[model samples]
Target: MEQLKQALTSAPVLILPDPERNYVIEADASDQAVGAVLMQDQGNGLQPIAYLSKKLHGAELNYPIHDKEALAIIIAFKTWRCYLEGRKTTVYTDHCSLKYLKTQPSLSRWQVRWIDFLETHFHYDIVYKPGHKNKADALSRPAHVAAIQIEGMNPLLKGLFTHGYTIDPEIPLAEKRHLLQWDNDIAYRKGSMKIWVPNYPPLRQLLLEEYHDVLYAGHFGSNKTLTGIAKHYFWPHLAKDVQKFVTSCDTCQRMKSSKQKKAGLLQPLPVPEQPWQVVSLDFITGLPPTTSGHDAILVVIDKFSKMGHFIPTHTTAHTEETAQLFVR
Candidate 1:
């Protein structure tokens, strides 16, 4: 054993349980200094499952207090679900903050939903270990092995599910053209002109089944329609529809106010021939008391040279005081 250890000390050694299961992970600076191990119970004996020497990005970072934590919880729950995909298992982490899984008092609405998801899915145990001992499992494997990017599911589907498809061919050609035109206009405006949909059949089906109500809602404005389409569809596609719908809305035209003409058409004022020869004056008010107990500023601008003086004053400054300030 001593000879083998010396021979293998310089090589990357991987420890595994019985030969069937393989786990891959890497450690960051934080976890490298504090090694971790994993132990699995094999009925007759305790097996050394994995060893990690580094930190995983998500677990060790100081994530934000609200939405980020909720995201972390969802990530953790998903990881746990994958770990126990087809069987019951025990999970452990050193993050004691997660101990309040069931009854977290200050969790936001989203976090509560995540907790409910954890409760509904797999049955498992979450044990918190001290940071020093957490190295056994925490350091044994990299943190990202737990990350599974499950895309295309409805955001509300808080559990694992498969993607399903449907088709619709009855949408009118005129409506399709209108949608295409709007898509193109928006794509051009947003500098995403490269986007294309080879066949509109699947999109037609998706819109008809999932987005028909929102699209047909009363005189869909750009912001409202964009928000509606984006909820169920990807942004680029929705941007096109939003651009088209907004451009075609009759009610928007009738109610929209005409934009004011540009002000730059007027000639600029002549430059001051002499500094302090002519002056524009105005009073600034409603300020908090300054160190000098003043709450206003009398602004005097020289009309010729465009220079100005700001004199601070109390609210009670009389006409005589104002005259004195201007002279000063």
Candidate 2:
């Protein structure tokens, strides 16, 4: 009974591939390597059946992320042909562009070749899963992993940035256009190292999300999130956008620690040793005018003895008058 309980507590483990069950492959690619895990759901949730990893070399190392991701899927299908040939297979990738590989209008000679192999051999659907959600991310990195670079820009972000640069009225302003520098497809200010971001809501939102919402970015508050993002990327009202996104974040709202100071716990005051040893004094004003024109009462109390004195005084009494009354 104890052994059965322990086994149930842990997650499902590797299992033999079931020919009847459809296969799920979660694949990811780093700059120099690609990795994929072959899984099958046999009654229990998705369990690993096999894992594949390959190191990129020469020109392969330089292949853009799209090709590398496609290669990862192709290799997985080739390795698991026996189990996945006739069975309907699903490929999950962090690169969103791979989902539309078949319909992409322009393709390089090598990309077409890679696509040809997969199309002829495999019957599968490619789905987009965020990089943080993909399971094979760890297996895809080289021996020395990067510190904090996100996998790659999402397809939506890339498209938005491209279109934004063209239509952004601010970017073409005389002061900025004269200072802008071009590196490949990216635009930068002549003297600044930060990547210039155009005025695009979707692109800005995605950037804000990637820097603040992702696990590595640590759902930080507006100020810190803005600071981290500003280090490498620049746009108008960047801080304002970060503040808005952070304020609206569902996780931040629910999980953020309260900033209010907690009230101090009540503790009993120390007892006085003798009468008049400690005393408190105050004046209560705003009373109705009295017969003698006195409208306030001076209150004095002794700590040790449960005794108080109420002295009549005018609301406008001077400091000297109050002191004389205290002496009296």
Candidate 3:
């Protein structure tokens, strides 16, 4: 149990699956339970997308090793059907008998049913792997239980339910009506977190700090940070707040560079119809003083005629003087 906890928390072993990448399923079965690990190859190596496990009950406990392993694959496929259904998947098991499972001349009723289900529902390649090489082996055993912390209700929500008003006055009124509801003294949403985040400055700032500056948070970009926070909390304009917080974050400003592409293409200016009507003026300064006591020249160009005018002037001429000179 301790080892499982350590393994789970040591680093990020699981990641969101990408549809463009191929998937691998590693399944194993113990006498008591069956477990499977879903993984994807992202060029770096195999990264886990999810892990599933369930205890054996009823007739499942009496199944032999071959049936148990095959059952693990079936259960795993059904559990992750959304991701596995249309993709090319490879199923790995320690049982070598499964390598040619379809070729077996004789089959039990359960085996026949399982084979039919596998052939009909999924497109997969079954491969035999040694137990020691299977990463999901520990999950199949009884010792695979790991300590996990569930984010309980947000602190601000408790205050609202108990006192009928939250401490934070800044939290919008519409959010309470639109986003939240209570049942059995516990908050529930259509598909949101049990935790509620009040728009109070202190609590909101604290939440941002925990997710942005904390060691585990890794100071990721605003979108990822908002996604992570949304999994466990909710507030009105939460995404707007996340963007504001990330934009103002000092560490992010200093360490990270912008990856966004520049907006809009350059458009050329329209050509002029006549000379002097669309003239451009520029000062050429820092020249050697001339006999006329002028150290700069104003060069004006006519757009249509390409005509040029050179006007001598003092380098330090004020705006009004320059304007008068242009008019003259």
TM-score per candidate: 0.30, 0.44, 0.42
Model 1: residues with Cα > 4 Å off, grouped in runs: 1-39, 42-88, 105-109, 136-322, 325-328
Q: Is candidate 1 or candidate 3 better by TM-score?
A: 3
The alpha-carbon deviation from the true structure for residue 324 of candidate 2, after best TM-score superposition, in angstroms, is 99
Instruction: For model 2, state the Cα shift of residue 27 in Å.
Output: 0.7
**Residue 298 in model 3: shift from native, Å?**
99
What TM-score does candidate 1 reach?
0.30
lDDT of 2 by residue, 1-328 (tens): 7976456334456678888889999998876688999998898788888888899899886676568788888788888888888778999987767888889899989779877877777788999875667788778854323333333655665667789889888887824458677665666555443568888777777678877787776797887677556645788778788888999999988998878798899999999999998988899999999898889999999988979999999999999999999889
Writing each residue's lDDT as its tens digit, candidate 1 over 212-245 gives 2332354444664454343223433556665765
- By descending TM-score, how would the candidates be arranged? 2, 3, 1
Model 3 lDDT tens row, 115-206: 89888877899987756577777878534111111225456645444343255553335455576555555443433323455545666676
Task: Tell me, by lDDT, which candidate is best.
Answer: 2
Q: Cα deviation of 53 in candidate 2 (Å)?
A: 1.2
Which ranking of candidates, highest lDDT first?
2, 3, 1
For each candidate in the order shown, give its overall lDDT on alpha carbons. Answer: 0.46, 0.78, 0.75
lDDT of model 3, residue 176: 54
